[model samples]
Target: MSKIDLRKNIVQYMLERKQLAHISARVGIVLDITGSMQGLYKNGTVQEVVERILAVASKFDDNGALDVWVYDHEFSRLPAVTEQDFNSYVTTQILKNKNIHKFGRNNEPLVMEDVIKKYTVEEQSSLPAFIIFINDGGAVKSTKKVIVESAIQPIFWQFVGIGNSDFEVLKKLDSMEGRIVDNANFIHLEDISAVSDEMLYDQLLNEFPMWIQAATEKRIIR
Candidate 1:
């Protein structure tokens, strides 16, 4: 399919699901660039997901752009991705040199800390933030600490595990103690392409609105 048509289909799918209809939060995409994800990046799975998520961000984010970060042992922000430049952006910034494969570790807490510090503690925007964190394996030990600490912030973490690897840490996040509220959700995708858009959207978004409401009651978000 042509890139334009693919983009349209993604937008249409999100609209049909009302994924962006009731939310007005900034969207951030935290992609795991570990070695395990090399196949997904090379096979265009990551590219397609980025495009679809950008469609939702365009409707919900005030800037109509997605703040992207790629993490391995650490993390760094990429240029903001929008529908118009997403194709060229990924080609030049991520796919051309196979940069996504360069990262060798999977320290998820670092990425979480960076986002929370930047968006919650520093900028302090009134609108809540929705963070889409994609990973294929478990995170470092520090991830639990960071996640529990982040429960008080105005952010919702949607964790998508894109492979068959055991996601023990993510699976136990909801039951972990000391969290102000359950601010994270995990969904495993064995075959990302085979998953229908409706199912993917439902899994990716199911717990976010509840977190928003809970965070508001706790004064994490205004």
Candidate 2:
């Protein structure tokens, strides 16, 4: 089989295993454009991530379009990426856009708020929203409030720390208190390239299915 077919099949199998093949969600990706992540952007690692994520969206997302956002101190929500237009998406949609706020400081809460609005307010879907957030480092305490508040919404935050940087704030996601349900999860990958696609998919999907069940039972999602 061809590469795209293989990718879709792999994701399909993962969904079936999780017993999540029957569910549909809206998928989004939040990428950190702070100075620390410049190397990943320049070397095409971020592009590879988009392709892998798009594969997951194809199987799980209702529309199969991965909503894209890149951020530094400010965030810009770019176009949604579908299978046909995902090639060179990061380079063309993000890096090439002079209007994008690129490579500066970290302000996770600003973009985190935008993600919540995009899924919970703007789209207003009963289906759950699955967001893959990629950050290199520079976690701040203020980001906690955003995640805590979003717990009641129909959104699940899956945070992926892609480097050896101290992701202190993110590490607290699972244990955070005052949330109706645990809406966030974090995973650290020192070297994303060293991990296989199956492993990555497993890690990403590990907590999501459980969250869906919990959210449904609690009426957070219908």
Candidate 3:
């Protein structure tokens, strides 16, 4: 597909144009690169989502960029994605990387911990972060513990399930115990192309404003 087509799809299904000015958090994009996601990467859905996320970050982040990561059995930190390099970066680092297509078990905690270490423990910056984590199925064991621990940090995890997989663990996260605040949201997208931008953005970002308010009151973000 042409880059224009990808941009059009992003505008049609992902950009929250009206809400951009209100968002002030730094952003991160995490994609599950397990075998099940091969079709998504091949058909350009992953690329489109990446572009859409960058669109949001460009408006909200001072740097106009996002940290990107991919995982299966483990996580790999990719070079930061910005508007300029987004297309080439995905083409070379993701679609063309031999390691991306390998089949491995899903491990969500690894990515979660990586983000926590970078933004929470290490930097300890008060800038709240929003993470878009896309996966096709349930995560490996330890995801629950990692998520619960991460709740105390200044981050919001928005889990997007692509395809028809059952996201049992993600669905139960909202009601999970021991969290300082409900810091995560989950949505399943059966057909990425068919969803409207407003609907997808609404579902993806609806809880974030409330999260920012709660986190600020808790002194997690200043």
Candidate 4:
């Protein structure tokens, strides 16, 4: 199916079922660009991921653009993508960008700080921020503190693990204490390429509506 139909059929149907049809928010996607991810990038799996994610963005974001970021030890905050430019986004924008610090070690806190800064400081908005954070394990301990501090803000982090790695920090997002409200969720998909779009969308969106409800009640999204 084309992207428009994918948005109108699968994602929108699920959003309506989950009662999120009228919700409005900013959408963004962050990718892990460590050495281990080269295979996924080379095989075009990353581009497919972008297309699937852009369909979700089309529904939730007013302008139908998905804000983009790829991070390793350092990061590169790329341009936002819409349906028009989402084709081959990973190859054209990320892989070819000489300035992007790619294939380094994973430093979750460094990128996490910049992500919070983008929503809370740079382009401050009242709308809640939904962030899709994809990684292949190696989640450092420093990310816990950042996630805890971000709990008070209007951002929800959805962490998706794509490969078989010991995702210690991401696995504990829910039970992490001292948060004003639960602000993040983690799901591991051993091979994202193997998952059907319907299932992938379901998994990606599972807890976001719940977060919207909780963040609303806590006045974190007002």
Q: lDDT scores for all predictions?
A: 0.79, 0.91, 0.78, 0.89
Ranking by TM-score: 2, 4, 1, 3
True lDDT of residue 52, candidate 3: 71
Give lDDT tens digits, candidate 3, residues 98-165. Answer: 76644477888877889888887776665788898988886765788888888888899998888898
Provide TM-scores for the models. 0.88, 0.98, 0.87, 0.97
lDDT of 1 by residue, 1-222 (tens): 865456546655664575446668899999888878888888788888887778668767889889998888867778889867887565577767454445588888777888998796777889988989888886776788888888888888888887888888888777889998888888888787888766776677778767877888898888
Worst 10 residues of 1 by lDDT: 11-20
Model 4, span 1-222: residue lDDT tens: 775665557888888888898898899999999999998999998888888888888888877899999999998889999988877789989998899988889998888888899999999998898999999999899999999999999999999999899798899999999998999999999999899888888888899899899999999988
Q: How far off is residue 123 in model 1, in Å?
A: 2.5
Best by TM-score: 2
Q: In model 3, how large is the Cα lDDT of residue 39?
A: 81
> Model 3 off-target regions past 4 Å?
1-22, 98-101
TM-score of 2: 0.98
Which regions in candidate 1 have their CA more than 4 angstroms from the true location?
1-20, 97-101
Query: Best candidate, lDDT-wise?
Result: 2
Query: What's the true lDDT of residue 182 in model 3?
Result: 84
* Runs off by more than 4 Å, candidate 2: none
The stretch of ten residues in a row with the least summed lDDT in candidate 2 is 1-10
